[model samples]
Target: MPSEESEVVVVGAGQAGVAMSEHLGAHGIPHVVLERHRIAERWRSERWDSLVANGPAWHDRFPGLEFPDTAPDAFASKEEVADYFVAYAEKIDAPIRCGVEVTSVRRHTHRPGFRVETSDGTIDARFVVAATGPFQRPVIPPVVPDGAVPVQIHSSGYRNPEQLPEGAVLVVGAGSSGVQIADELCRSGRRVFLSVGPHDRPPREYRGRDFCWWLGVLGLWDLETPPQGAEHVTIAVSGARGGHTVDFRALAADGIELVGMTRSYEDGVLRFAPDLAANIALGDGKYLALLRAADAYVERNGLAFPEEPEAHVLGPDPDCVTDPRLELDLAAAGVTSIVWATGFATDYSWLEVDAFGENGRPDQRRGVSREPGVYFLGLPWLSRRGSSFIWGVWHDARYVADHITIQRGYLAHGTTDRPGLTPASGNN
Candidate 1:
C-alpha cells in the first residue's frame, strides 16, 4: 500500500474537522483531512428534506467564517447547510481528501505518532485528531425485541412522510429528532404515536428572542463543565417548530398519542414504563427552572430586557399513564413504521488503543487524550456547552492546534498560541 505522511491528521470533513484543519493551516502546520463521504454528509444524507437548522444562521457560524450575508437570520435548510460546509472548505482551500474512510488508527511504535489506515491508503502523522462528530452511531434500544414491525428506521434513515407507509407511525424516543419527526408526520395527515422519555423541554423563544441567544447571553455557552453528571440526559427541542419547545401536552392535543418510555417489544405488543405523566411533569419542571434562572440573572444585572408574555403550558393529563392504552400492539394500532430517535452512541472501536475508560470514553483533559499525540474534537461538553456546535468548536479546536504545535516545538513561532489559545492541560 502507498504511504503518506503529515504533521497532523484530521479524520472527518464535517464542520469540526474543517475547523481543526483551518486552525492547523493558520499555524502553518502540514495536515490532511479525511472524510468517508462528501463534506457534511450527514446534512446531505441523514436529515429529512424539510429539516432546517434548529437556530438562525448566525448561531451556526464557525470561527473566522460566517453564514452568507443574504441568509443571516433565516433557518438554513439541510442542503444549504451542506453547501455552506463545502463552500467553507473550498474557500479556505483545506487539504481534505473526500471519500477516504479511515479504517483504523493505532500508535506508531517506530516513532512518536499514529499510523492511520484508510480505504484509500495508509498515513502516518505526528498527531491524530478524531473529528468524527458526537453522533457517530445510531442507538436503537436493545430491548426493541427481535422480529420488530416491518418498517423500522433510525431517524438518520428517515427522510420525509412520503417515504412512510399508510397508517399510524410509532416514533420511539421523543428527543429533538423524535418530536420533530412526529410533529411533521402528524401534520402530514399521519396518525403519530410518540413514546416519551427523559428529555429537556426549552421554549423556542423564551422572551422575544430565541432560546439559543438567551443561552449565549447568559454565558451558558461558555460553561466548561465536564461531560458526565446526573443532569446529563439527551436534550429534546424542536427545530421544525422554529426552535420552540416540543410540548408533549400540545402534541397530545394535536391527536398524537404520548406514551411512557418504551419498556419492551415482544409478541407485537410494546410495553411502556407507565410513567408518562410523571416524565412530562419533570421535563416541564426543568423548563421552569431554566426560565427562573434566566429571570434571576436579568434582574440581578438590571438589564433592560423587555418582558414577553407568560409561558403557555399544555397542562398534564392524569389519565395518560393510568389508562391501559400504554401497551401498544403494533399490528392492532395500525402502526406500519417505527422511527427510533433514540440518540447516538460514541464508538471508538476503530481506535487501536485502550484510550477508553470503564465508562467507555477516552481519558482526556479537554481534547488532549492521555495517550499523547491523540486528540478528540466535536464532542459535547468537551470544553463548553457550544463545544459540539459549529460556532463553539473553535474553543477546543484552537486548543488542540496549540497543543500539537507545542508538541512540535513550534509554539515559539507565535503562530499557534493566541492569548486564549494556549494548550489547556486542565479544565478551564
Candidate 2:
C-alpha cells in the first residue's frame, strides 16, 4: 500500500470521474479520483428502482451543477440522479478516492507516466483519466440459455416490479433499459415481453420541446454519429410516465408484449427476429426523422414552436407487429422473468493501453489518446452527440482539461515535439 503519486490518475468516481475532477481542478492539475464504488455508483447501486433521468432536470445537468431540488422539466429521480452526482462531488472539492479499485492501467514501465494498479495501492501517474463511465459490463446476450429464466437478471440487476418472479416477464432489450423495464413490468401486473431491437423513437415531448429541446435546437446534440441508418439504433426515448412517447404503439395499447430480435434460446424455444415489422418500421423512421428535424429547425430558425399533432402519430401495427411472433414457448408462454435489458459493456479489461482499437474501443481522439498520457473520460460518442451526457461530461471534461494543459506544457519543456498532441479529431 505505498507508491501513490499523482499529477492525474482519475479512473472513475462517475459522472466521468467527477467531471475529471472538475476539469483537473480547473487546470491547476494534480488529480486523483479513483472510486470503485460510491458517488453515483451506477446511479446509486445500479439503477432500476423505477429509474429516471433520461435527460431533463435542465438538460441532464453539470454546467457546474444544479438539480438539487430538481424540476427544470423534472425526470431526475434515480435517487435524484444519485443525489445530483453527490452534489456535484461536493460542489467540486473533487479529489475523490471513494473506496478506490482501478486494478491496472499499464504504460509506465519505469517512468514517463501511468501505473495506477489500485484497490488502494500503487498510483504513480503523470496522467491516466479513464473516468470509467460507459456503464461497465452487463451485456448478457448468451441468448438466454443457462437455466432459461426462472428469473434472469441484468437491467443492471433490475430493482422494482416487486423484484420479479410471479410469472411472465421477458424484456430482453428495446433499449432505454428495455423500454423502461417493459414499462415497469407492464405497470407491475406483470406479463410483459418487449424485445424489439433497432430503436430510436425520440419524442418525450415535441413542439413544446424537450426531446432534449429538439436535440438542442436540431443541431441534433452535436451529432458525432448514429444518424446514417442509425448505426445499430437504441435510444428509444422515455423518461418514464411524466415524460413519454416510446409508444411501441403506446406499449401495445398498454398491454406490453412487443417481441422480435432475440433469436435463439433453443429447445424451451425463444427464437424471435422476424424483425417485428422491421422493428416497428425502424422506430417509425427514427420517429419521422426526429419530427422532420424538428420541423426543419422550426422553419429554419423562425422558431415560435407550436405544432404537436400528437407528434406525428404512427400508431396501429401492434399484435406483436401484426402477427409476427417468430417463436416463444418458454413453458408455453408463462415465461417467469428475464429482464436483460442488454447493454453496457466497457470493462477495458483493466486497460493495458496500446490505446485500444480493433473495436475494443478507447482508440481515443477527443479525450486524446494514441497513448501519450492516455486520457478517455466517459464514452458513448466520446466527443459530441452528448458524449455520455451530464452536460456532455462537462464538455468532455473541459476537453480533457485543455489537453492536460497542453500536455503539461510539453512536459515542462523538455519537449518531445508535442505540438497540438495530434490524434486528429473526434468520435473515434
Taking the tens digit of each residue's C-alpha lDDT, what string does model 1 give over 1-428? 78877778899898889989888998988889999999999999988888888777877777566677426656777888898899899988999999999999998654456788999888877778999988889988777665576688899999999998898999988777888899999999998988887777877777566778878887877888843552356667755644566677778778888898888877889988877877787788878877877788778989787775467444646455446256888899898899999878787887887577789887887798888888999998887888888788866899999888787774234535575432222111
In model 2, pairs of residues that clash are 168-336, 247-250, 261-273
lDDT of 2 by residue, 1-428 (tens): 88767777888787888888887798777777878778878887888787888878888888766786877987888888878888878887887878878888887654477677887789777778788878888888787777766888888888898887688888888878788888877887888878887877787888787788878766778878756776556788878767887778878788987878888877788888887888789778878888987898788879887887766868578677889778889888899888888787788889898998898878888878898888888787877788888888788888888988886776666333665432211101
lDDT of 1 at 360: 87
TM-score of structure candidate 2: 0.36
lDDT of each: 0.80, 0.80
Q: Kindly provide the TM-score of model 1 when superposed on the true structure, using C-alpha atoms.
A: 0.91
Show model 2 residue runs off by greater than 4 Å: 1-104, 107-110, 115-136, 139-145, 148-169, 172-177, 180-205, 208-244, 254-302, 309-332, 336-339, 342-374, 379-385, 389-398, 414-428
